[model samples]
Target: MRARIAGVAAYLPEHTLTSAGVEARVRAAGGGYRPHPTIVERMTGIASRHVMRDDQQASDLAAEAARRVLAERGTGPERLDLLIFGSASQDMVEPATAHIVAAKLGATCPVFDVKNACNSFLNGLQMADALIRTGQHERVLVCTGEAPSRAIRWKVRDRAQFVDAFAGYTLSDGGAAMLVEAAPDGGIFYRDFAAVSAAWQVGTLPGGGSMHPRDPEFTYFSGDGRRLKDAFVDNGPEIFCTALEKTGLTWDDFAIIGVHQVTMPYLEVLRSILDIPAERLVVTLPEHGNVASASLPLQLDTAIRSGRCGPGDRVALIGLAGGVSLGVIFAEL
Candidate 1:
């Protein structure tokens, strides 16, 4: 038996924050260094991003998406043999967010959380595939709810602080869910992942951990965008090339290729490096910003709805995270 992606769904909050609005907020916050009004849109090519309601928690978002996926498949929560909550943001630090999501969805299945920055969902899918192939589980639900908006830094002290907080401005709140089930048919066939652990310091949200348990100063997202970009440029593309070599498959073979999109320039850079065709991509960065772990699923859902990909079609999900990790998963729908 193979683990196949049976269904996928995505949820985006109604509220939106435009790049111009972000600039206005920063300026209103009385920051020491004023950013140019067009800087955010010009630099990142992100016109706007979604914002969750103040009352919504990470579990709430995940549950919403999960419900849609379950309903679409005509499967109840009880039918899931396992559930995985994969996200960079969580409702709290004590109990795994998976437990909360399960409770919200009325699912009593075994659950856990997987955290690896933006690659959390991909890792969850990898784990589910392995478990199903090994005969440990028959069905699995992998879900993510990212509320990076809570950690975005609006007030900057100076140019240095603004640069450090730049990545946060590109973040958006969203949720996604994918159901993986055992099927005697085409499914996930190839996967490759590589990371530069030394470059882990390139980006971070330092709060809610042992190092800064009570420091309010460490509660915002900060990073050096240039360094992060260089880290990927130095260590990324080889994984994709190697996967193709091992699988004897070329980029054109996939009907739809969903690559994690953070910025237009970086997406173009990766596309050029890999020689991926323009039409193969589902470009969501401009409107949705970076939705963290939900990005790949969002793209897949979009492609499926638009008839870009469907049953018997090959698909590729390429992931890039702040930990400077790169991953690729090839599957058939």
Candidate 2:
């Protein structure tokens, strides 16, 4: 048995924050230096991105996507045996956001969460695949609500700081849901994950943690972009090629390659490293920005819906996160 994606849906908040809007905000915040809005667009390939309402919770976004997926599949929340809310953003610190999403949907299924920064959704897919293959679960729902835009620090004092925080500027708010059910065969066939603890400090969301619990002002996300790029560039090929080797497949085998939507240049880097053809890749970062865990499903669903991918197409999911972790999943649609 394998875990197959029966349906998938995505929800983007109504509010759109364009690159110009972000630039205006930076200027209003009295930043001594602000990059031109077009600079962000040119570098990150993001013209605009969704932003959640101030009053909305992450669970709200996840529920909306989940509702659509369930409705499309003609399945009720009550029929799901497991719910996994995988995201970088949560409703709260203690209670899992999955529980809140379940409550919103009036579901009584077992609920939990899986967190791996931007790779959360891929990790959840791996877990769901294992459970369904072993008969522990029949129907599982994986959902993500990402709002990294909320963590942007608009008060940067220098160009370097602004550049370091550029990742946050590219962050968008959205939700995506996928319904995974047991299949007789031909679902997920290969998966791999690698964690580089040494490179963990390259990128981070520094806030509300035990080490710096008192720094209320440190809620903004930051990263050494050049360092991250260098590290990934140095090691990315091995990471991706190993997964292809494990599956006895090559990059040419996949019909559509869905990668975590971080930035345009980074996606190009991945393309160069893996030698992937332009047509074989799905590019969503330009319109969606970096929706974190919701990115992969959103890209996958968009490709499928747009006729860019068809039934029995081999889909390759590649995820790279702030933790400097890489995960890959190969599945047949």
Candidate 3:
């Protein structure tokens, strides 16, 4: 048996932030470092991105997306056997955010959380697939509410600090949901992951965890952007090949490929390495920015809804997270 995606949906916050707006903010913040509006737009290929209200929590976003997916799948929350909340943002530090999301959606299913930075949603999909394939669960709902805008370090101390947090500028807010169930076929054809734990410190939120106490003004994003590119360029070929090998399909077999929404440059690198043509690739970064874990599914939903993909089509979703993890999931729709 295979775990097939019955439906997919996404929710984007109403407020939109443009690169020029970000430039204005940076200038007003009195940071010694300044980011040019055109530079951000040219480098990341992002003109605008959605932003959730400051009052809203990640669970709220997740619930909105999940409700849409449940309705589209022709089922209620009561039909879900398992609910997975996969996001970089959580409602709180104590109780799992999954419980809050479940309550919001009126779902009484077993709920849990998965946190793998930007790869959380893909991780949840793999778990859901395993459960369905093993007959442990029939229907599973995976959702992510990524609000990276909340943690962005706006007041940069210097040029170096600003450069380090440049990736954070691309962060956006969004949610996505997918429903998977046991079926005879038409599901995830192959899935796999690779990690370089030694490079885990490459991307980080320094002040939120145990090592560093929370500081509202100091909650800045940090990462070695060059190192991330180097890692991807180095490991992408082998990791992607392994997944294709498992499915006995290559880049030529996919109708559309969704790579992580980091930046246009990163996508270009992957496109070259994976041998995926520009026409066959889906580029959402220009419009959505990086919504973290929600990005992959959101892109997939956009592709399907826009008629870029249809039933019986093969698609691939690739993920890269802060732990420097890489994953590929190929599915048939």
Model 3 alpha-carbon drift over 4 Å, by segment = none
Per residue, candidate 3 scores C-alpha lDDT tens digits across 180-209 of: 999998998788898988888888877767
lDDT of 2 by residue, 1-333 (tens): 888888889999999988888888888898687667578788877999999999888899999999999999899999999999999998888789999999999999999999989999889888899999999999999998887877898887888888778878889999999999999977888888887768988888878778677696778888987788787777667878988877788778888999886788888887887888889888888777789899999999999999987678899998888778788889998
Candidate 1: list runs displaced more than 4 Å.
none
Off by over 4 Å in 2: none
lDDT (10s digit) by residue, model 1, range 135-156: 9999999999999999988888
C-alpha-based local distance difference test score of model 2:
0.87
Q: TM-score for each prediction?
A: 0.99, 0.97, 0.96
Clashing pairs in 2: none
Q: What is the lDDT, from 0 to 100, of the residue 324 in candidate 3?
A: 81
- TM-score between model 2 and native: 0.97
